[model samples]
Target: MIDFYFSKDQGVKVTTVNWRIHKLAQEGVITRISRGEFTLGSGISYSPSLSNKQISLYRKLKTEFPFLSICIWDTSIINEFMLHQPGRFYNLVEVEKEGMESLFYFLKGKNMSVYLDPSPELIRRYLSDEKDPWIVKLLITESPTQEVNGINTVTLEKILVDIFCDELLFDAQQGSEMDRIFKEAFEKYAISESKMLRYASRRRKKQELEIYLNDISKYRQQPNFIANK
Candidate 1:
């Protein structure tokens, strides 16, 4: 809005207004809310902390299947955005589908509770809230991931999409809590909507996710956005 006024009333270039906005944010005068959106609050970024168990499990899988693409992350990462976070959290290990069964057995051999691509029925029948378990799942091809401490981990974008799509698996992050989750996620992280939509498309939930995003966010329908990465 400031940029538009400057351009129309004072003949200032959009580039100059943008540069000013960037400099103002750098100096802490204004906060960047997505691309051009601005606010008074400070910026927040998402960073996942890896547990020893998560690290060790990732290493074992990497050593066993060095060529496979695997991502490891803990569900407790959502605690940063929740008021009713549960005491029990679990590990999520996603890899290509072909090696899923073998990896499940390998993990099972270690005497830890593990499940492979569980159904809602399986979750109800066997998954225990009293204990932490590792779930082996099929990693959607080209799902956004990053390497943290030399281990591949889930990105904020992927987590948002997963929670939106998997009601049974991510029951903890649903209903009213889901609204808060998405609102906090957008506020606290540099997430890319395009990347998230691509993953959702792979999961066949792109359209649904888009509608949900529109319902929850004002910036979701922006014509342009500068991805913060």
Candidate 2:
């Protein structure tokens, strides 16, 4: 683990240290494994490294709204879990509730393919064939995320929760495909069920999701699979 210490002789304030830590995390110089804790190495996980354009947009928006939480990721990441591949992928930008409207308008005025919490109808009408459609939504509470290459992106846990709960938004990753995703994700990455369940509880789906996950575990012939892993 990378331990961060503040020194008074160097005249570093707590806020300065905090900002620097966030900066280093954004640049992948360090990794935030949990709240107020960091470690070295890339570690096994699912997190997208944003493209330059995506990072630039995030930086600009963050500067405009410093206190707002933001997360961006490409839909291409979902292709791995999709049985029927989507022709065009989207760039989703999720922001805090209070900043959603303002940011959406600002991005729209700038001629970006920006939309505010697109519905299934709107997605089919405008975003289906568009190249890199930028969809913005209000960030859900307790959503898990990771910073990669100076930008915040959704973590695997968040992705799994979304795939399970959001049928409209993540329609492509359903039924048997959902099973495949869960199986592949657990096998390929080191997932924290505690973190996932905490976030799912915030979404009010913890019990049901837990039941579903347990069923999947039993089906896989690995009872108490996730917690044990």
Candidate 3:
């Protein structure tokens, strides 16, 4: 939907092209579908609307660590794909490695239901039943993310990869439930397998997760999808 080179050849200034694109994006008439790629209409919506709690916490964190990368999401998003809902929910707060320790201690001191890089066993035993636990993990480099109202959250690609890789953290989403998750996600939104695989590679899940994704697509008879505008 965007043809910057063609526009430039037709005597459009680069700045003018960029400003028009920005205006369209602000109006939601077009959206950035990937890095350097914009689509003409509103694209798929992912994640539930941000709750007041989610927004407030993200703002507090941003004010304190303006330079750090962070993403936050509610566990309620998973419930849309889960058949057997767990008793408790969580707000996952993924941050850069350098900020993990400080944020963990800060949240801990405030007496929030917080855990830092919990083991699978630890999660299965204790935190699984606790209410609204805040799980902090190191954000993988190059994972795709988006910002809404200044709050950064994982992209659908990143979320699917995280569910695939972390068994302990997302235990309930395995097996048939995972199939449902993938199916529902694919049916509801646009997915970029290339983006997912690249992030999976960054997370050291390239080969295994690729096989898993391919297996999931076997019955659908679809072409390979990629991360492009």
Model 2 residue 216 CA deviation in Å: 0.6
lDDT tens digits, residue span 165-224, model 3: 987677778889888888777766666777888999998889998799768765232221
In terms of lDDT, which candidate is strongest?
1
On a 0 to 1 TM-score scale, where does candidate 2 land against the true structure? 0.74
Better of 2 and 3 by TM-score: 3
Summarize candidate 2's per-residue lDDT along 76-130 as a digit string, tens digits.
Answer: 7877756678677778898889889999998998998788998889977877667
- List ranges where model 1 is wrong by over 4 Å: 1-44, 219-229
Write model 1 residue lDDT over 76-184, tens digit each, in one string: 9988889797877778899998989989999999997888898888887777554788899999898989889899998888898999999988888999998888777
TM-score of each: 0.79, 0.74, 0.77
Clashes within 3 Å, all models in order: 0, 1, 0
Superposition TM-score, candidate 3 onto the true structure = 0.77
Positional deviation of residue 209's Cα in model 2 after best superposition, in angstroms: 0.9
**Candidate 3 deviant stretches above 4 angstroms:** 1-43, 219-229
Off by over 4 Å in 2: 1-43, 82-84, 218-229
